[model samples]
Target: MNPGLPFLPQNEPSGHEDEGEPTQTPNLEVKLAGEPALTVAEYVSLRTEILKLIELQAQLLSLALLSLGALLGVAVQQRNSNIAFVYPVLALILSFSWLNHAHAIHRCARYLVEAVEPASGGALGWERFVRQHPLPFGMLGYWGVRSVFMGSSLVATLVGWSLPHPTLLTVIAGVASSLLTLAAFVLFLVWRESSPKQLKVEGHPGSTA
Candidate 1:
């Protein structure tokens, strides 16, 4: 046994043992190769932040849906389609905010998988496992939420068109809103579909952990 590995038992030669035989101890240090530089505490902090962002993402989506319903209700009650214009602008802002949160979440998760897990000797492998085995209907749920926003924007455009004398500004705004919403949805899909290996290479911006 090596003196450096105190826990390992020392080997003693017996009468039947060959004189040329050598005792062997496991090379535990090899496991440390290619390990990341992050500390355990940093990994924990990053994970906590990611959990909070997920909760925030859900809340933002709820708010977007509720706001849409309320705006549509008021437009219908007043018989004024002009109010529908507000939904697109509001939805655009909300969608951008949602995307920000989503991007941050993705960045952090990628960091955890590429950096922290290796350092911890596979003890922290949840992120890596998730990447390998994604949940069913995950993309479907993503598209569903985006569809709700896009569909509502289209409805708002139709409402604007229903007016007896729709102004050019209203028509332009409605069209722009629809286009912007569709663009946002497509951008989100592209970001999500990007390879994790590419993200790791790019590294996260403004990430302290």
Candidate 2:
């Protein structure tokens, strides 16, 4: 027998050679092709601030919509009392709604920017991230809604001034209100329809299956 080889005197080895040892995995390093930038808290805080702004604006727009609905109810009852004033009130509310929508959109855009900043030359590309956050699409929908409201309010104001007959103006206003309602419903439907479903995936290291 070779000197290097161990000679089996009589019995075979008791332990299984196949079970000598389990394989070991080498350590892996995951790196992006870029430089490190912001501190964790800073990054988180920035994202939090942006999301908070979006939430605040969303609440504000919701309040405006609610107030507009209430004012519309009051206007319907008080026909002879120059219901045109309600239009101006709603106009003011719509202004605030528009501003809030724009603000929310801006913040959502900023958050998106921060998210992709590490990737390359600051671009989010066309991805669910823009929609995934929820705020961006919400703001966009609200923004479109506020535009419709603003137009309705303006037309009501002008029609009230020109046409002294509340009867005919009432018909026009009703049509505008109906159209606005339909517009809001449709925009909501589109946004909901376009949104993608999220899937949950689970994984574990060293899993055989």
Candidate 3:
């Protein structure tokens, strides 16, 4: 059992797992204090902005990973053991990138919870959403699917670099560049999908300036 969380009551009189467990429920409320009161369209606008931030953050993560891997490979060729040393630097980069990614998702989720429901409820509810939604929180609907494309490009880059030759750096660059482009494309698509819709909001829900 994890030491940090609250100790659960014995689930059963016989000390069984299900004897006295506390049942958990999903409570969907995502409101924030600083955020403007948003309509559905405004909420979607924030979603679009957050999508761009997420896509950029993901690209940064993949590139940072690929960077560490390639630097190690290059250092290997140069007989430089310092390649191992720089891994910590790579880790720092990764941590920052991931933190940014998480922040972006949190921003989007905050709006969804707060915009849809005025009250954000309690800590448990926030924790529940965080766990269930994980990284990208695909509830952004179609935009979340873009992760697949990004993941694919990153994998391709890594595979190309895994070859047993120095020339494979080209492939690695290709992979990183491709993922970067995909990230750009995701942002473009999000803005494209959202901006026009924002314009045509004659009596529509969530329309915004």
Candidate 4:
């Protein structure tokens, strides 16, 4: 034996050693952003209100279409082809109004699907219910309503073109309708593009988590 036992090797501090610090869990604050977390009942009620709004939009569209038809019929009976331009003008207005309402309905439905359903954690089925029982009218969905209006208007315009006594007013009507339709479509595109990528759920200020 040299001195005490051979020289003992000393323990070395390793770079990978964990310092006895407490681990932290990630913040899982699942919130609806601008909107407060709503109860299941509140979600359901809001969904119902949206559905009612969609129904009202449909009813208003129907009334507008009926009025347009009546106006056309009266104009024809009175042999007033000079007022032919007025028909397209009215159609443009009605179509724009209808599309605006449709957009509102779409926004509400999207909120229900994206926010409401997710928060429900499989408890809410309002999205499915709305799909199963859609709003009244031939309106099946977003594209369906848009197509219906565009298609019907095209047919009506073509028919008007074939009418007797095509005057300057007729041409003016045709041009105005086409321009307004284009304008409305452009505006819709702008609105969709300018809309926030994230959905902001409007909620009471007190509900912020």
Best by lDDT: 1
Candidates in order, TM-scores: namely 0.67, 0.40, 0.38, 0.55
Q: Tell me how many clashing residue pairs each candidate has.
A: 0, 0, 9, 0
lDDT of 3 at 35: 37
Give a tens-digit lDDT track for model 4, residues 1-209. Answer: 12354443233445433665432223223454323446566686777877787787677568657756775676567655434435555656666676676567667776776677777776776664554444454224544555444544554455455566457866777676566556545544454311211222122223332
Better of 1 and 4 by TM-score: 1
Off by over 4 Å in 1: 1-38, 163-169, 189-209
Roughly what TM-score does model 2 have, to 2 decimal places? 0.40
- Residue 189 accuracy (lDDT) in model 4: 47
* lDDT of candidate model 4 versus the reference: 0.55
- Writing each residue's lDDT as its tens digit, candidate 1 over 87-205 gives 87777677777778878988898888887878787777887777665556556765776666567666766675575435777667666766766765665666553344343334454
Q: In candidate 2, what residue range of length 10 has the lowest lDDT sum?
A: 195-204
lDDT of 2 at 156: 50
TM-score-wise, the better of 2 and 4 is 4
lDDT per residue for candidate 2 within 109-198, as digits (tens), equals 444444544353443233224433445346565446555555555555554444444476665665564455454444444433122122
What is the TM-score of candidate 4? Answer: 0.55
Q: In candidate 1, list every pair of residues with a backbone clash.
A: none
- Lowest lDDT 10-mer window, candidate 3? 194-203
